[model samples]
Target chain A: MFLAFVAATLVITYFSARKSSGASAYFAAGRRITGWQNGLAVAGDYMSAASFLGIAGMIAMNGYDGFMYSVGFLVAYLTVLYIVAEPLRNSGKYTMADMLAYRLSPKPVRAAASLSTLTVSVFYMIAQMVGAGVLVRQLIPGVSYEVAVVGVGLLMVVYVVFGGMLATTWVQIIKAILLMSGSIFLSVLVLREYHFDLGEFFTRLTAIESTAPDGTKVVRNFLTPGLIFKNPWDQISLGMALLFGTAGLPHILIRFYTVPDAKTARSSVVWAMAIIGLFYIMTTFFGFGAASLMGPDYVQANGGTNMAAPELARKLGGEVFFAFISAVAFATILAVVAGLTISASTSFAHDFFTNVIHHGKEHQPGQEVLVARIAAFVVGALAIVIAIILGPGVNVAFLVGLAFAVAASANLPVMLFSIFWKRFNTNGAVVGLLVGLTSSILLILISPDFMGENAIFPLKNPALLSIPIGFLAAIIGTLLSKEVPSEDKFVEFQVRANTGLGSEKATEH
Target chain B: MNDPQPSAADKPPIDWHRIQRDPDFSALVRSKARLVIPATVFFIVYYFALPIGVGWFPEFMEKKIWGDMNIAYFFALSQFLMAWVLAAIYVVAASGWDRSERTLLAKFGYTSKH
Candidate 1:
């Protein structure tokens, strides 16, 4: 089944690459995707293996605290819709750097933005590949972890290097449908097992009993928080990351430009919110149902919480259901890696190659696409190497958490200031990117994820500290910097970003 | 993707300052702000309320509503509804904003040549 999905996406890449021979087509799918299509693609791009496997596993292990992630992920869309989506779609050509450089000096601003984009995407890609290696190995007995990682890497490279955003978008749309159908099916199955009695389901889920070390009977309620988020401040920090992070995610932000206009961008967020929101709500049933049916002990024995959803599938319909859902999870990773590779490659070719290295010269029709294809292959190779070295046992959820922290801290502040503040100069944008990137990474390195238990940074997520530094660095740097944006630059940007006055027109073909 | 757009520079340069001051533009911006600002604030506060509730006051959040269905579950579920309802509302309100934008665009000669 997984091979079948891979074969289908490769076919899509073949056809998409033919027309995707130019910079515009390669980068933004010729800006021809409709709102609903882009919406599904965005859903596909944003919902990583973490959302599919990690969240269910967390619930199977931690309960209400895990549900907190779902809420944070969903509500974060409001920030995107209200503050950034239309503005980004109107102003940005291909990459996040374009949005930042609208008012700031282009070369330095694009360079900084590209650095941040690559960092975030690479971190995210590595974690996905590692998780994919482990998940694939679990499903199929013969494939070694190293081989699985390399296979995923090559497939993603082909999708982006050839098909670019067009193939990536279609792959994501298919992944979203498969994921939603699988989850909905599992949710129904879970409900049916309890005779569709919600109360009965909850009762069974929470009534999971065990014996303590002293042989005392212990009843564990899987319905509460605190089991995971023992620290109160950690919850707030995580909340901040999830709330502010999506607006800064490069792959997600670029999806806005894949549609034709600002109005389509705005509508796409709504469509995404609807699909993503429904999927997350269904996860509540899926996660809780997993706990009720399989119990945490069974899930933990089978290799922790990531196995919860799959284990529940096995119980519901034997081996066939498990294989189908496992295939869907693999497809989820493929779609995400393809999305990340495109975003990273687009940034490399568009911002770094064209702007910084080539001094803003127009590339011949296929030149930019060629550079982008090479970048995708390089990025995929780097991620695969990292995934192989790290091995399959690494906790990937933290890496994802770190990616969000960096995005919120580094990218969101610059993005918000660039689009909103008139006095936000080139100095601010560059400094914001550098400071946001460094502080979040440094903090994470010192935190428990990298260092052992006792750490320099108390919080697991650095966003609580790093987000403020990002904003303040931008604000102070702007106030202290010598270069001020010319009056014309601000006005032109406001007009373009706000009203879509001079937005890029999409090619219909 | 990298270079400043050629078509934008080639076309008649928009009087950005005039558009900035246009009443229709102001109305659109102001009205969208009116809805978006309050809605954004309400939802953020509302979203934080649940996490804070779960984090800070677990006993209260864990209070069972129906059998083992806790208050926390309901509150969390409500957020899904809140997002969908708010997003739906924003899209509907934006349609009116889109109409006004088109009307003003034609007035200001900002219509697309393509």
Candidate 2:
């Protein structure tokens, strides 16, 4: 059943790529996408299964605090809207490197930005691949885990290789709509079945708690997991990364470039917000419904609360709902992977190959596009290998938080200061990116999650340390730099990006 | 364009007077400031408010809404909505620009129309 869905998604990609206009079309949808459509695609790209399944599962398992994921996810969009959307639309040449290198020397910034984008994207891609492996295994009763991982990986490569961003964006838009509609429908049905009696649901759940032979009550709350230091602190740090980190994510940020203007970027974000909010609300219900209906024994039997939504659907909607949820889960992986590939490809082609190597202007457009498509295959392959080794046990949602922290700490500071501050030089931009990326990674490594249950790491989230470090690095680096960039390059980037008339106009004037 | 005019009397050694003119430039300054100031203020408030609010209202947040969900859940979810909404708003509001603003932006190497 899952294999069939994967094949269909691949076919969609092949057909979608028939009219491809080469690299720009693949990377930024030819900058022709409408604001609302792009917004939906952006939302699609941003809202992964980690959100749909994980948030609900977390909520069902943890209780009131579990909803922090949704809060963090939603609020992060505001940060993107206010700080990034217009400026990125106005500054970036084609990728993160374009934005950073435009104001400073192209050499170091391009190399650094490309490496950062690739590192984060690959790390993120592994998480998605891991998710794909899990979903495929769970949905199909007979399929082995290895088969599922390879199947999803091959299908993802096909999707990206053929469809590019145009096909990917449309796919995401459709998937987002479907995911939202299905979630809403499921939430409503669950509520109607209970006659809006949430209290009754909880009351029954509480009353059903079993007792041990010693007479101690069975503590069956889903929110509190069996891990050491499984407290609210981990939850809050995870939330900060998801919320603010969304603003800085390379894959999501690149989506803004698809629109023709800053205004469209703005409009897309609005549409994305409305859809995301509605979907989250529905997910909360799904979580609660799964917890109440499936019962702790059943959940424990079927691999814990993470499987709550699927098990509950099996109980309520039966085979059809199960298939539907599983398909949606698969689509979530596809949409996110598509977005990640595009961002990675953009970094390689636009940032490294064209900008750094070509000194911002030597490559034929066609060749550059070809290099990017090739890079996509390589990235996909790497993700597949990592996923196979790591297996499917890792928490994808948490990794997404890590991705955001790296992006926010590294990309956001450089991006924010470059356009607004005149003193920002190339040296400053490069150091800032390096410092931010390094510090965040270091902090995360020492974090409790990375400590491997040893209780050695004192902190859970490095954001408390890294976010400030990123900001400070950018500030101090800029202050210490002596070389000021020539005014022409900054003007050139802004004009080409903002006007969409290309570089000719800037040079002509 | 105004014709160039020069004072016959040697300009004051200290250059006592400075040329200041153009209502449009003034208007541009005001318009730009209007957007920049509020946006900056809002950003600081939103980013800083959550950590502070979470610290201050932990007990209140512990209260439930529907079943297991609570105030913290709602706020967290709303933040995601806010992020996207804010992006959309920036794009919509910043796209339009007058000729002078365009020229000034162009002078700075940014194309004004996009």
Highest lDDT against the true fold, candidate: 1
Model 1 chain A poorest 10 in a row by lDDT: A206-215
State the lDDT of candidate 1 residue by residue for B7-48, as single tens digits.
543377668889888888888888988998899889989988
Q: How close is candidate 1 to the true structure, as a TM-score?
A: 0.96
Docking quality class, candidate 2: incorrect
Question: What lDDT, from 0 to 1, does candidate 1 have?
Answer: 0.85
Q: Which ten residues in a row have the lowest lDDT in candidate 2 chain A?
A: A500-509
**TM per candidate, chain B:** 0.88, 0.59
Across residues A1-509, which tens digit of lDDT does each residue of candidate 1 receive?
87899899899989987767577888999999999999999999888887878788778765667888888889999999988898888887998898888777899998999999999999899889987887887788999989989988888888888788999999999999999999999999989988998878887777666444476866778887777778888989988988999889999998998898888998889889988998888777878777767766677777565667777888897899999998998999999999999999899999999888888886575777789889999999999998899876655665677788899999999998887788899999999999999999999989876788889898889999999999999998888987878888788887777677778878756
Error (Å) of candidate 2 at residue A249 is 1.3
- Candidate 1 has an fnat equal to 0.62
lDDT of 1 at B64: 88
Provide the fnat value for model 2, as a fraction from 0 to 1: 0.24
- Estimate every model's Cα lDDT from 0 to 1: 0.85, 0.68
Error of 2 at A200 (Å): 4.4
